[model samples]
Target chain A: MHAYANPARFLRIARWLMPALLAGGIVFAGGALAWGLFYAPAERLQGETVRIIYLHVPSAWLGMLGWGGIAAASFAEIVWRHPLAGVAARAIAVPGAVFTAICLATGSLWGRPAWGTWWVWDGRLTSMLVLLLLYAGYIALAAAAAASGANRRVAAVFGLVGAVNIPIIHYSVIWWNTLHQPPSLSLSGSSMAPGFMWPLLGSTLGFTLLFGAVVLMRMRMLLAGAQADSRLRRKALSAGEAA
Target chain B: MLKPKHQRMVLLAAALTALLAAVLIAAWALRHQASYFYVPSEIKAHPPEADRSVRLGGMVRRGSVHNEADGVTVDFIVSDGRADVPVRFAGIRPALFVEGSGVVAEGHMVQGRFEADNLLAKHDEKYVPREMAGMTAEQARQTVAQTK
Candidate 1:
């Protein structure tokens, strides 16, 4: 991993990797969405409203996974002080928040017909909302740190602390009798039939790939921007001395 | 090179202090602000504050829904198999709010009766994804009932 920490080398490889991930993500996600919408049968209880899960579930999963990545990167930043860890955390933040917002919006649309309400302040929903807020806070903190070139520890600490919500979101249904249904898929084995599970799994994979591609693209942009800024700063300093 | 040892130490201390503060605030808020709903069995075991808003979630008991002539005021019973709580609402009913399906209502107890201000229907047993298609709502309810 450290071998890729060299910015120029990383960018060289990422330039090729980004398009591959994007194309793969588009194909897989688009195919899964089409399959889920057109081919899957309507649920017995939810009827046609069940189609939203193809997008909603994956976004929700990515939302949580995004924070989990931040927490891990924060760990690296704080403990090992990995040169690329902070960049990785910053790259994941905005995309993660976007996915969280998508999850909430899609869940609301799905909820109207299925749950009868657009939004509920139930444990699961509330905790998920908090996760989104946490992402926003992290993004703002990352920006402030970048502007000041301050110690990255502040954001890393926030990243670690905000991770508390992830477990809470996962267990909210069990701890509280929420309107949101319990997770169908878990390590204990899924309650979902294979017919529905296959498409959902495919969509989740596609979304994860998309998320990875987005993060890589953001990291490369940040790297290039930093390089440009430093080059400009050196030129200005030399011109000042020459004058 | 890293920052001076003292600078690093101070920053680490500051971060720890901030983290501690956040943890304390979260714990305090969650204790008071978090609202957990109860099923009928749980409600019966220990009723919550009658004046405080709480959520009551369970299946809509079959044949218990009574729509008043006003068409806005409706009465129903929510059951968790072992116990039941009667809920009354004076509002527009949702299109999916029906008998023998899952429902969650937001309200507090009024003299042991739930006076719900809003209703949220639940898609219980829908995520199962097998034997659901071609089955009408009633048949699905019966299948769920038989399984219970």
Candidate 2:
């Protein structure tokens, strides 16, 4: 991992990994969706509408996972000052926000049939909403920092501080008597049957890989931009010396 | 030259505006699709349009539940004293849904049947020291009320 910390080495490997990740993501996502949308039996209680769970649950999981990624990247940037960490953290922001929004929207869709209301201010929902806000805040801060050449360390500190909410969001359902259901899948046990579990697991893996691929691509772009800036600065300095 | 600080603020404002617009559009599109709550009596008096999806809420009438061979779908009746509406639901019933308790059913009215795609049972109103066994509506309401 330390060896790959160097941006040049990371880019070399990332270039090779990109196509494979993208292909795997498409295949797994497509297969899981097909199975979930068509092959799986309609829930006896929810009928066809229960299909929304395929999209909704995965998106929610990814939203949480994305934040975890941001937290990890932030830690690297702050503690190790790994040059690529800030770029990776910024890259994840938009996708994290998008996934969070998808989770909310699809959850609302599922809620109409299951809960009678499209929106609820329950503990689980509220915490998840806050998680979304954190993503937005991180993105806004990074953009702001970019303009003034604000220290990446400052952004990293904010990232670490914001990460405190991740655990709260995860355990909100357990700690509170709320309408939202508790975790269906956990290391201890899963309420879902094996048949349902397979597709869910497949979808989660696919989504994670997709997130990794996107983040790496965005990091590459950032690295390229930095290189260009350095070259232009060097050229201007040389011209001044010549003058 | 535009100050970098001002440039950042402008970009932030623009991004926020765009996000707000997208959210508003989605909310508007889904407004009509939003589900409404209805008691059994309301459903019987003024049934929803054939294709309109709505929720029915009330006590599950005693002796009105019959489980099918599949053990998943159950035919039951929801009642509000004045009226009882027959409902069909397929899936694992909520732990709370039981005879003589509040339930909410979501689906459409098709061919004189309130075909429920989902069913959720409301817990009792009393504060029972221990969780009670079986789906008992009266007990649930009693427990909930007691707790309150």
Candidate 3:
């Protein structure tokens, strides 16, 4: 873990990993989406509408996972003062927000067909909405901190604090009498049939890989910017000394 | 007792733990408000004032759905096994709003019956493939009703 504290070394590793991850992500996400849309059997009750599960579940998973990543990176930034941790947290925010948005949109579409409403203030739905809002808030806070040249720890602290919502989002349906159903998948097993399960798993893996690739790409860009900024500063200092 | 960075880490963990505890307590205290709807037994036990609007949710009793003489109105009984609440709604029912399926109706109680302004269908977590369903739709309905 500490070996990655060196920016050049991190960039060296990510240079190769980024394209590999992207290619793998595209292959798996594309194949799974195709299978879910074209080949997966219709649900007994929901029919073709059930196909949305492939996108919705994975997006939901990543929405939470993204926050989890932010929390971990923030911890590293604060505790260990890991050099790349702030960059990693920043890189994760946009993709996390995007996934959260996708989850909400897909869930709304599914709800219209399955739940007879486009929106509801139920526990599960509301908490997921809150997760999206938290992402938005985090993005804005992180941006503001960056612009003002404020301490990045301000955003890292928020990242750590915001993590309390993840568990609430996870257990909302079970804790409250929600209109949305309980989770279809859990630690014990899944309620979904094998026909839907395989494609959903494949798509989830694909999306996760895609998410990682985006984060790495952003980190690389941020690191490159910092390195260039430092070199320019050094050049200016040398010029001033010569004068 | 620890390095400065380690001390900060411990403090951060404590603060987050306290925050989580606070959130959990607040949520627990407001659990009733967090619930989207009340079941029949809950309504019977508490019986909110007739004009105070609330959502009543449960399964539609298998044989209780009836279309009133008015073209717009439908009447049905929502049962949570132990109790039942009769509901009347004047709106287009959702495609999934079938007998023996879950429903949530929003409105107020009038005399004894619930007068619903909006109706939304609810579904269970089960997701069987069409081929694996084995039972006919009617049989599936009956099975759902029986499970209640």
Candidate 4:
């Protein structure tokens, strides 16, 4: 795992794997969306609104999962001082924010008619909103750190501190009164019937693959950017000596 | 072997340890402070105290809403298929407030009814009029005021 910390080696792997991931993701996610919208049974209760589940669930899952990536990278950066850890965190942030936005938007659409409300400041929804803010904070802090070359420590610390919200978001439904429904899927078992479960699982897999591809893509860019920056710094130093 | 500089490593370890401790303690303390919204089914599964203030959200039972003589005080039932909670509220009903839509009421279960001091009506993502979708900020305020 750590061997991939070398930017060149990681790029070698990502170059080949990205196309495959994107292809597979498109097939699965596109297939699931079509199936969910056209083929899946209208829920006895929610009716057509149930289709939004295909998009909302995957995006919601990835949003939190993105943070998990950042937290893990932050841990590696702090403990092992892995050179690529910051790059990985930076790579994951924006895509995660995008997914979080999708989740909120799709959820609101589904909520209208189904929940009869588009927005609520309930625990689950509020915490998810907070996650969006946290993502923005991280992206800004990381960019500033990369620019200054000093105080990058604050960005890593922010990554870990923001992780506290992940658990809060997960447990919010169980802890506070919120308009959002309780989780349908859990490790124990899914509350959804088998019919609804298959496409949801498929879409989640597809979205996860897409997310992985995006992260790798961003990592490559960040790695190249850093390399260029360092090269410029070395050149400037030598030029000063010559002068 | 991959090793961070010793001084930075020690600082990181200390910071992480403190953060872990703080997160754990905060989570533990927040357990009580955070109250999960209960659907009628869960409420039936484990009934909370009648006097304890709590929040309940679910689809309002169709045709169950009844406006009292005063028009402000209304009674309704919130249901999650498996269970139902009778709720009473003394205030103007929100424009979106309707039977069979999702609602959240907060207060206490008093005398067999969930007496809510605050009632929030939830709307779905669809626009009925369609034209209203393109409304500007000023138009939105005017529309709201007109409704009031």
Ranking by DockQ: 3, 1, 4, 2
Q: A-chain TM-score per prediction? A: 0.97, 0.95, 0.96, 0.95
Q: List the residue pairs that clash in candidate 3.
A: none
TM-score of chain B of 1: 0.63
Kindly give the stretch of ten consecutive residues in candidate 2 chain A with the minimal lDDT sum: A41-50
- Model 4 residue B33 lDDT score: 57
For candidate 2, give fnat to 2 decimals.
0.01
Tens digit of per-residue lDDT, candidate 1, span B13-123: 577567767865775566434545678887888888877887888999999999899878999999999999999999877766889888888898888789998888876
Better of 1 and 2 by lDDT: 1
Q: Which stretches of candidate 3 lie over 4 Å from their true place?
A: B69-71, B134-148
- Tell me the DockQ of each model, to 2 decimals: 0.32, 0.04, 0.57, 0.13
Query: Candidate 1: misplaced stretches above 4 Å?
Result: B1-33, B47-53, B63-75, B108-112, B125-148
Name the weakest run of 10 consecutive residues (lDDT summed) in model 3 chain A: A189-198
Measured against the true structure, the TM-scores of the candidates, in listed sequence, are 0.83, 0.65, 0.93, 0.74
lDDT for every model? 0.84, 0.73, 0.91, 0.80
**lDDT digits (tens) for residues B56-99 of candidate 2:** 76788999999999989899988879988899999877655668
Model 2: per-residue Cα lDDT over A66-122, one tens digit each: 888887887666555577888888988888889899999998877766655677666
Please write out the lDDT profile of model 1 over residues A1-243, one tens digit for every residue.
578668878888888898888888998899999999998766756677788999999999999999999988887777666788999999999999999999999999988887777888888899999999999899999999998998788999899888878878887776566788889888777766555777899999999999999999999889888889999999999999999
Model 3 lDDT at residue A43: 89
Q: How should the candidates be ordered by lDDT, best one leading?
A: 3, 1, 4, 2
